[model samples]
Target: MSGPAAALSASPAGTGPDQVRGPVITGWSAVSPYGIGRDAFVQGVSSGRATVSVLDTERWPGPDELACLVPDFDVREVLGKKGTRSMDRVSGLAVTAVRELIAESEGAGLPAGGEEVALVLGTTTGSAQSMMDITRDTLIHEKPFYIDPSHIPNALMNCAAGQCAIWYGLKGPNTTVAGGRASGLLALNYARRLLTAGRAHTILCGAAEEYSPARSWLERHTRHPDENATVLGEGCAVLRLQPPGTHPHPLAELLCITTAITHPHHITTTLAHTIKRALHQTRLNPHDIWAVSPSTPPGTTADHERHALDLIFTDHTPHHIPAPGPIGDTAAATATFQITTLLSHHQQHPQPPNRIALITAIDRDGVLATALLRLL
Candidate 1:
């Protein structure tokens, strides 16, 4: 993440470590097939759109023609070549989106001078495309170790997070996460807990993933394509969690974040349970939530992913398919987009009281992460 100094209120009055509420997501940006920034996302969701082109169809090992491409974004505008070369497109997306997020609200998502900054990320596949490149060198070209050793660092799961820390000059706790699509929500929950527990005052927390060439090959070979409905898309969401307070452009107050895993058939029940548990944790009522940013399915579960989700939390308003659905890509982008949408709802219309925004994601691994965001 880049931009102005965002300072969290250190030792706010009347709040100790246990009393400290979870992080309030000040701002965020998403780079997806829908395009760059939040404006494109709102448009896509407004139209009920999805990317149509065949995914990774080429046998020659390269990116697919059709993707939810972010419109008009160049790294050079934000970083010099020296800094940009170390990052892959996926990591570039991860860092740039966070930078835009930080730009919206200066220095709130990060620590001021002398404060600790932790890096926690969630991703299903680290940089599988890089790995695929190396494998291609060996198999397709019969060239052993033909890949660049410099590019080998991104092959690990935590490489993205580590590189982000180095690139951004953050020197605090750092880690990576992989829980399938649930990685994003889990990352947020974990970061929130760390701040609450006083492990670190601030964090650059998010996840990164991409539809790699390897994923495409695997899907083509897999007998059951439906099993891989979750698209192999790459995106990341970085939220600077600070003790609860009024942020100038807060999409919503991240009241509570929680997760669970259940059978695919019982997803609705598990989702409801997670929502209930979050509410119980925060002492919130169903009617308090004005809208929900629910997850969209990629044909894995029944087409009734929304119906199944609504059956659990039918009392609240569910209008748009919030967040990731707008982009038609999978990963933590859903949760991050959900959070951004929740905050945007309140940002657009001020004084939206009790404007609780709920974000829920059902992952392929049967993991359900439900986050409660309040626009207080």
Candidate 2:
């Protein structure tokens, strides 16, 4: 068998949650092209081989030749009939990822009416298609009377966060963060606070984005391949944040997470500052970082962020695995992949450096968000 298949072939019990040390990951799931779960994603990024794959030509065409979107999985298998109707693709991806995380955490068996749990969700675009669909219906169908109000709820960017809290029955500190791509990293940091204050014992934190035709249409004209920028893609990433000693055999710890906003010109420098801030907050050095997981094709202003790494550290990143390389860009999913990359690196080698896993992004609208995350 291959890497991930080999890993999955083993019983989850041998290395499942309920078995590790402090600040454990407890649970995690990714809706990416590399497959679901951290192990599958790590296998693709570490495979060290090149492959070209077609992505969304029929429905959502983009300039890029390929993308790492989730394939071969059905939402119905994981989500039942009643729950599926309330979600948009973005929400679907997120909740699906969260389902896996919960299963891994054994939260799937959460006691009935366990209102102590809560969910903090994040997203750059919650239901782009819902908005587009309404517009198309109004223009083509020529009747506002037939417009569906159900999509109105799904159309909002915060719907993913709200839908998750409703479905999971979690009633804790439910905050929907808005930090552009850094939202995923910030979401985890937000959950950590709930645990710290004893406000919630386990917080489900995540980010999600759905594919949009308009976004793809714009990419064809605006994106630069040489610079490695692409269009919006669909996916979600979820992590279960728990108190330091709640579970064992859990993966990595959430050392700290922080965010910063700056002018587009200062992308790299700003990211460096935020990364150092994360290290400072955790009291560590840059060299101690074993890896830096930034998304590939670092958009215009954000390109400097990667170049800045060269200036700061002599060691080329152990693996320049830009997350979206194995799992197309889902905006917020960038931070999700960042978290997975960090945990994957740790699982491969014991005693990973108390390093900062950095993420930076600048959107076409000129908004930039930079964040740093580390294991505790």
Candidate 3:
């Protein structure tokens, strides 16, 4: 009981019965480029080792030759040889992450499965390669409509979430949210709403991304020509969220999640305003945030995000925890990874009670999101 578990059980000096409470993160798991599970991710980020590796052109030919992929990740091998023949990479990643999360929850003396537990998964697009391949087969076959039915499920945008629910027998609300890099935060917000509405008692929330030639080519064509290409990364991170005071060993309390959309030219100002609003709503000042994790990929968006952060924290500079440098551009999973990064850092450094951590995410489609978490 000397680690996070102990911290959660002890009441902080200033906290009282009147203290406000929000959704609490009780447990989490990750399937990351560094390897798999929360320990691998924490170790990789803590060691500051590079996870990028050379791609095999024969297997994954694409515009980019390098990527940060979950090493030695084979669907059948990792998930076993049953019911995985037609499983796409994204679905496999999601299922694996949820499986780990359920196990972690059970280990922490919580019921891992029940009718009231929900699942909310976020993604930019389910599996680009599965969709493209299915389309190619449809046109090249003797009959235009002839295609593998087994692969059809993977082509849908909700495939990963559906697979997770099916695998876990989750009877509560199952949802899929799509918002590019802002997807993780969007999913978190969705889970919070579900709790507030009394739709579920517990929620498994996170995002998953897969690295493939289809996604690589799509990113290449969509990116601005002047911007330098970053090494694409893929993985999944899932957190178990329960209503505040429901869990005894909570890791952090989520105060607020705010998002905004604006014209590309006004992104900086809009994001600054969004951050300020989140702070005001939480009744916390800039100096209260002990760390900041910003989803900075590269180029103009990164500059705009930095500018927005500078605008708010003019007097107090929080410790920066960068996500992309070690994990690459995780796309949909960026924000989720940022939260995991803060959690992992807290485990090692043991921040004081009630200290805050902030996360900001921006997507190329003019979506900006901010979340504030109070460490236990």
User: Number of the top candidate by lDDT?
Assistant: 3
1-376: candidate 2 lDDT, tens digit per residue:
5432222121111122332222435677777666666666667557733333576577555455565456654566657788676467777777777767766666433334546676887776566567777778778776765777777787777787777777776677677777666677667667666665567666778887666565555456655664455534567778776554465444555555556666666667766666666666655555656566765444554457666566656554444435655455667667776677666665665454344455555443344444444443
Could you estimate the TM-score for every candidate?
Answer: 0.79, 0.79, 0.94
Alpha-carbon RMSD of each model:
5.8, 8.2, 4.6
The reply for model 1, stretches above 4 Å from the true place, is 1-21, 38-65, 72-78, 107-109, 138-146, 221-233, 246-251, 300-308, 314-321, 324-326
Error of 2 at 154 (Å): 1.4
lDDT of 2: 0.61
Off by over 4 Å in 3: 1-20, 107-109
TM-score of model number 1: 0.79
Is 2 or 3 the stronger prediction by lDDT?
A: 3
Which digits, one per residue and each the tens of the lDDT, describe model 1 over residues 1-376? 2111122212222233333244666555666666666665555545557654454455325434544445444556545688676566567777776666556546554565415777788887787777777666677665776667777776676777777777666677788877776777888877876766667766667776665566556555642467444444545566666555434444445577778878877776777778887777777667666667776646654343566556655666544435555455655556665665555555555653445567777775578887776555
CA lDDT, candidate 1, residue 137? 68
Better of 1 and 2 by TM-score: 1
> What's the lDDT for all of these models?
0.62, 0.61, 0.86
Query: What's model 2's TM-score?
Result: 0.79
